[model samples]
Target: MQDSESLQIARAMRRIPRWWLIPVVVLVVLAGLGAAYWAGTSTTAGTESTPPLAAVVPVSATVERRAVVKQVVLSGKVVAGAESVLQASHAEGVDRLVVTAVAKEAGSHVAPGDLLAVVSGRPLLILPAGVPLYRDITQGEAGPDVESLQTVLTSWGYACPVTGSFDLPTQQALGFWYKAAGFKAPTASDPISQGEAGSAAPKPSSSDIMFRWREFVQVPGDTGKVASIAGSGAILADDGVVARIRVADDAIVARADVVQAEQFAVGMRVTVRAGSTALDTTVAKVSSFLEGEHSENTIPGKDITVALPPGAQGFAAGQSVTVTAGSAATESLAVPLIAIRQEGGRPYLLVQANDQKNDQANGQPRRLEVKITAQADGWAAIADVDGLLVGDEVTLQ
Candidate 1:
C-alpha cells in the first residue's frame, strides 16, 4: 500500500504544469528582494547625517559717507607746452642780422642782462620782460622804453633814476652795463670829438653813452631755458626767429576715444604715472573732437591735457606715461547698488532696525526713501533722508 501511495504522489507532482512552478519561483524571489529593500531603508533613516534646510536670510550692507568716483586709465605721453620764440628785430641802418658768436647754447638758463650772442660785432644782451625793441634810444630822447631801461638798471644797483629821459645818469648806467659785459659802450655822435676830419679815430666821451635797441632783446618772461640757438655764422633777415625758449615745464597729454572724452573736463584732478613714479595734477585743458573723415596718419580722438603741479620733478618731454582721469562727487552717504531698490521710478533703500540692547540689527527691514546724488562704479551716492543715518545696516535687495 505504501508503494502505491508513493507512486500516486509522484504522478501528482509531475501533473503540476511547468508554467505554474515558474510563477511560484518568481513570487519567492520578489518577496526576498522586497524584504532586503525594507531593511536598507530602515537603517538609512536611523543613521543619516544630513541636517534639515534652514530659513532663508537676506544679505545686508552698511551705509557710510564716501565719494562715488568714476575713473578711466589711458595711455599718454609727456609733451612740452606752448613756448615763446625769440626773433631778431630790425635795427637802425641795419639790413641783415649776422650771428657772430653764440655765448648761450641750447638748455642754457638765461636771465635779464645776460649776454646771449654777438651779432654783427655787437653784443646781444637779454633785457627785462617788456615790449620788443622798436627803435634806437638816443642820449636825449624821453620815452617809456627809456624809463623801463632805467628801472632795470636801478634794480641791478646801477643807481640810475627812472625819469623816462635818457639823461647823463642813464648814459653812465648804460656804460657801466656795457663794461660789465666785456664790451665798449658807444657814445653819442659828437662832431667836435672827431679830431680834424679823421686825423685820429674819434674818442668816445667819458660821460655819454647812447642806447642802441639792436644790442638787446627782450625776453618774453622773467626767465627761460634756451631750447635752440642759431649757428655762429647763420645770416637771417629782420623778424627771423633766432632761438626758441621753453617758458614752462612739461605737461602730460592723453588721447581718449570720442565716446570716452565726454566725461573729461577742465579742472578735473588726475594721476599721472611713468615707470614707478606717480604725480598728482589737475587737467589744464581738453581738446574737442570733431566728427569727420580722418587721414590714415591721423588718430581721431580728443586730447586731455594735464599740467604738472608746482615743484613737480622727474618728468621729461616725449616720455610715455599713464593718465587716470575721471569725475568724483563730494562726500555723502552711499551704499552698494544692490542695496538700492526702485519703486514707481523712485530710488529707495531697505534698512534694518537696530536692537538697542545688543546693537544688533535683527528686526525686519524698513523701506526708506532716498535721493541718489550720483552713481558710479557699483556705488550710489545718496543724500540723507528721513530715518537714514550712517552706520545703519541696509539690506541688499
Candidate 2:
C-alpha cells in the first residue's frame, strides 16, 4: 500500500506543468544571448572610434611696403608766443589820467609809431625800443641812448647823425619830430632844473632845446596785435596796464602737457590741428615744474611749448587744438600687428603657402624671423628678414 501511494505522488508531480517549464528555460537562454551581443557591439564601437587631431587654424594678411611713424598725441590750446604790457608810465608822469580816445581796438594790427591811444588829451605813440624815459632829453645829454634816438629819428626821414652825442643835428631832428607830432618846438634856453637832472643842484642849460620824450611808448620789437584795451572812459593810475599786445600772426604757439618729458626735446617736429586746419610746427620749450595751485589727487606732468609756422593764420587765442609729436619715419616692409608673434624673446611671423596639399600633409607652418624697427597706426615696420616679399600672404596664427 505504501509503494502504490509513492508512485501516484511522482506521477502527479510530473504532470503538473512541463510546458510552462519549457517556456521559462527558453526565456533565460534568450536573455543571455541578448546581453552577450550588446557587450560585443559596445566593445567594437569603443575600439574603432578615436578623437580627431587638432585642425590647422587659418589666418592671412598681405605684406606691403609702407611708412611707419611713431607719434605721441596730446590735447593742447593756442597761446601767444610773446607778449608785452602797455602801462601808464608810457605816457609820462601822468597818473590818474582819463582815456580820451581809442585809436586801435583789440584784434587790430599795429606797427611802429602807430597811435595806440590818447591819454590826458595827448597822443601816446608807439615807437621802437630805446633808453627808458626818466626825464626830458635835452641838447647837452650825450650817450648810447642818444645814439639810439638819433637812429630812430633818421629812420623817420629826419637828417641826423648817429654819433652817440646830442649835437646840433639831433636837436634839429627833435624839432622836426615835435612839429610833425603837433607839439611845441624845443627852445635852447629851457631851464635844466635839479629834478629833471636827477640831482640836488640845479644847472642852467646852454642850448635852447626841450623835447617831450616821455610822451612816446616804445614797443619791444616787430609787429603785434592788440589783445586787450581799456575803454575810453577808464582811468589809468601809475604803473597800471592800459593795454596788452601779443605777437599772434607770425609768432603763434601751442601749450601742451605730457607724462614723459624725456621723450620730447627742443627742435622736434610736431603737427598741430585746430578744427579742420592743420599746421606743422616745432617744439620751442619744455618745463617740468608744477606751477600754481592743484589738488593733492592730481597727477604731476610736464609742459611743452610748440611754435606755429608763419603759414598758420586766422587762429585765435584760447582756441582748442590737438598736437602730434612724431619720430622719424622708417620706410620698410610692414604688416598688421596681429600677424606678429613673440616666442622666447624673439619675434616671428607665420606665412601661408599657396599649396594646400603640402600644408595638410606636413602640418608644419612656415615662419620668418623679423626685427621690428618702428610701430605706428596698428602697423609695424620689419627688417632683417629673408624669403619674404611685398604682397605675400602671411598667417596670423
Candidate 3:
C-alpha cells in the first residue's frame, strides 16, 4: 500500500501543467526589472538635485583725482550791438559826393585818425569824439570847435594851446597831421599888405595850413571794428551813410527752455565754441519773454546773452555757435558711480582693505561711508571723515 501511494504522488506532480510554471517564471523576471528601474531613478535624482559651492568675485575700479561739473549745452548765434554809421558830408568846392578810394574795408579794426575812404579827391578821416565840424577852421578862429581840435592835437603829442583859438601852434600841429596822414596840407589865405611902402610881410603868419569841414568825421566811440563800407566809385547824396562800425563786442544770444533757463544766471562763466575754436566768456544778461512778445513765430522762453571776451576772434554775426554754461568745476577724490552703494539712505563704497594693493585675497573688503559732494559724467566726487585716498581700489559689485 505505501508503494502504491508514492507512485500516485509522483503521477500527480507530473500531471501539473507546464504553462503555470511559465507564468511564475515571468513574474519573477518582471520583479527583478522593476527593482533595477527604481534603483537607477533614485540614484539619478540624487545626483541632479545636489549643487556645488562656488566662490564669487567682484568687479572693481581705482579711485582717482578728477574734476566734476554739471553743464548745459545750448545752441546760439552771434549778435552785434551799438553800431555806428559813417556818413558822407557835403564838402566845399565839390559838386558830386563820390567814393574815390576805400582805405579800410569791412571787418578792419580802426582807431583815432584812421583813414576811412576818399570822397571826390578829399580824404575821409576818423577823429576822436569832438565837436561837430559845422564850418571850416581857419587862422585866428576862437570857439569850442577850435578847442576840440587843440585837445585832439594835444593827445597826439603835438604842442598846441588848448586856448579855444586856431593860433600859430594849432596850424603847426595841423601841418604835422597832414604830413603823417600821407596828404598835403591846405594852403592858407593871402595876407594883406600894410601900405605897399617899406611894409613888413606881417610876420609871415604862423603857418600856411587850414582845416576843411568835410575832411574829418568824429566817431562815436574810442575804438571800433568796421562792419560795412561803401564800395569805391559809389555815389551818395549829402550826409549819406558810408560805413557801419560795431562799437561793442560780439555777443552770444541763445534761447533756453524754462528748465534750462532756471539754471542760468548773470556772471556765470561759459565756453563758446565755433567749429574747432573755443573761447571763455561770461553771461551778460538773462531775460524772459512772454508768449508772443518777442516774436510772432517764436516760442516763449528765456534769452541768454553772453559777452565774448575782449579781442575774441573767429566769430561773425548770425553765425551758429555752441555755448556751455554751468556750475564751476570741483576737483576732488573721485570714483566710478558703479562703486557706490546705498544703504539706509546713506552712500557707501566697498574698499579693498589689503595694505598690499595687489593682494586682493589677503583681506576682506571694508565698507566706507562717504559724502557725495558732487556728481558728473558717471563720476562722484566724495568727501569722508576717514579719508579715501587716490589710487585706492574699490569694488564695483
Candidate 4:
C-alpha cells in the first residue's frame, strides 16, 4: 500500500504541467526588466532636475583725473568798435555847398591831416579830434575854441600854451603852422598904432588863420578807414551825412543777445574765428542794456567789445564770426559719465570694495553718493565722496 501511494504522488507532480511553469518564468523575467528600467529612468530624471550654479560676469572701470570745462558758444559779427558818421556843415553866412572832387574813395585808409575830398572848390582835410570849428580861430579870440586850436597846433609838432586866451605865442605858432601847410603867413598890426586916432586897424580874414570853419572833419585817434562816401556831385546840406569812418585804434565789437550777454564778463577769454584763422582775445566791455528795437516776441542784444591783440588783423566789418567763451577749468577726481547713475533725484556711483574679508558687508559693489561739479567730453568732475578714491575700480553697470 505505501509503494502505491509514492508512485501516485510522483505522477501528480508530473501532471502539474510544463506550460504553466513556462508562464511563471516569463512573468518573473518581465517584472525584473520593469524594475531595472524604472531604476535607470529615475537616476536620469534626478540628475536633469538638479539646479545649476549662477555665473559671475566681471565689469569694472578705473577712476582717473580729468579736465572739465564749461563753455558757451555764440554767433556774432565782427564790427568796428568806434565809428563816426560825417555830416555836412558850413560857417556863418555860407548858404550852399557842393562836392567838387572825391580825393579818397570808399575803403581808403587815412591819417590825421590827410585830405579826404574837395568841397566848394576847397580842400576838405581830416584833423585831430577837437571842438567844432564854427569860426576861424584868430589871435584875438578868447574861448575854449582857442584852447582847442592851440592843442591841435601843439600836437602837430608846434609848441604853444593851451591857454584859453590866444596870446602872442599862439599867433607865432599859427604863423608857423600856416607856413608848414603851404599857406601865406599872417602879418600882425601894431597895437599902439591901432589905438591912436586916425589909424584904421586891419582885420584878419579866413585865409589868414591856420584853420577854417567847416573845411575839415576831425577824426578821433591815430588812423581810420573810410566806410562810405557820398557821390562827388552830391550837394552838401547842413546836416547830411557825407561819409562814414571807422577808427583803427578801437577794438572789434560783437553784439550778444541778452541771454548770451549775461554769461559774459569783463576780462573773460574768448576764441574768435574768422574763416580759417582763429584769434584769442578778452572781453573788454559789456553794455548794460539792449541796443536795438525788437518785436514783442524778440529780445534785443547788448554790445560786447573784444580787445584784439597786436597783429590780429584780417577781419572786416559785417563779417560773420564765431565766439567761444569758457569758464574757469576745474581739475579734480573724475569718472566716465556713464558710470554715474541717478536715483530719486540724487546721483550715485558704484565702487568695488578692496577688503575681501568682509564679504558679507562688502561682497557686492558699495554705493556712494557723489556730486557732479562740471562735465566735458563724456567725463564729469566729481566732488569728494567717501570710499571713492583715484585709481579705484568702479562698476559701470
Best by TM-score: 1
C-alpha displacement of 237 in model 4, angstroms?
8.1
Candidate 2 vs 3: which has more TM-score: 2
Q: How close is candidate 4 to the true structure, as a TM-score?
A: 0.54
Clash pairs, model 4 backbone: none
Encode model 4's per-residue lDDT on 189-275: one tens digit a residue: 321112211224454443344445556677777477887887888897677567788775346666678788887899989888888
Candidate 2 vs. true structure, TM-score: 0.56
Write the residue-wise lDDT of candidate 2 on 1-397 in tens digits.
9999999999999888767788899999999999999999999998896889999668789999988987777766777457778875443344557777778898887776577776665656676766555556766687777888788889988898899888878887776665565433435353321121133443333255555554567667747888898889888866667788876443333333444555568898877888888888788878665553365333356667777654467566778787788845757999998899999989998876655323444645577788989888999898847777887788875
Show model 1 residue runs off by greater than 4 Å: 1-68, 72-78, 87-98, 190-203, 231-241, 254-269, 273-279, 284-304, 308-322, 326-334, 337-362, 365-375, 380-393
User: In candidate 3, what residue range of length 10 has the lowest lDDT sum?
Assistant: 190-199
Residue 114 lDDT in candidate 3 = 87
In model 1, how large is the Cα lDDT of residue 231?
88
- Could you give candidate 3's per-residue lDDT for residues 211-307 as a string of tens digits? 7766777667767989899999999766778888889877898877777787679998888899999988889999966453555445568888999
Instruction: Report the C-alpha lDDT of model 1 over 1-397, residue by residue, as the tens digit.
Output: 9999999999999988788688899999999999999999999999988888998988999998998877788888888755778776655555678887788898898889898886666677889877346776776899888898888899999979999998989888888898787676765674121222233454577555687676677666668888889989999656667788778767888888887677678897788989999887888888888443466333678888889753467677789899887544579999999998998999888888777423334566778888988888899999877688889899997
Could you give me the TM-score of model 1 versus the true structure?
Answer: 0.57
Model 2 C-alpha lDDT versus the unseen true structure: 0.71
Worst 10 residues of 1 by lDDT: 190-199
Give the clashing pairs for model 2. Answer: 187-208, 187-209, 188-207, 188-208, 188-209, 189-208
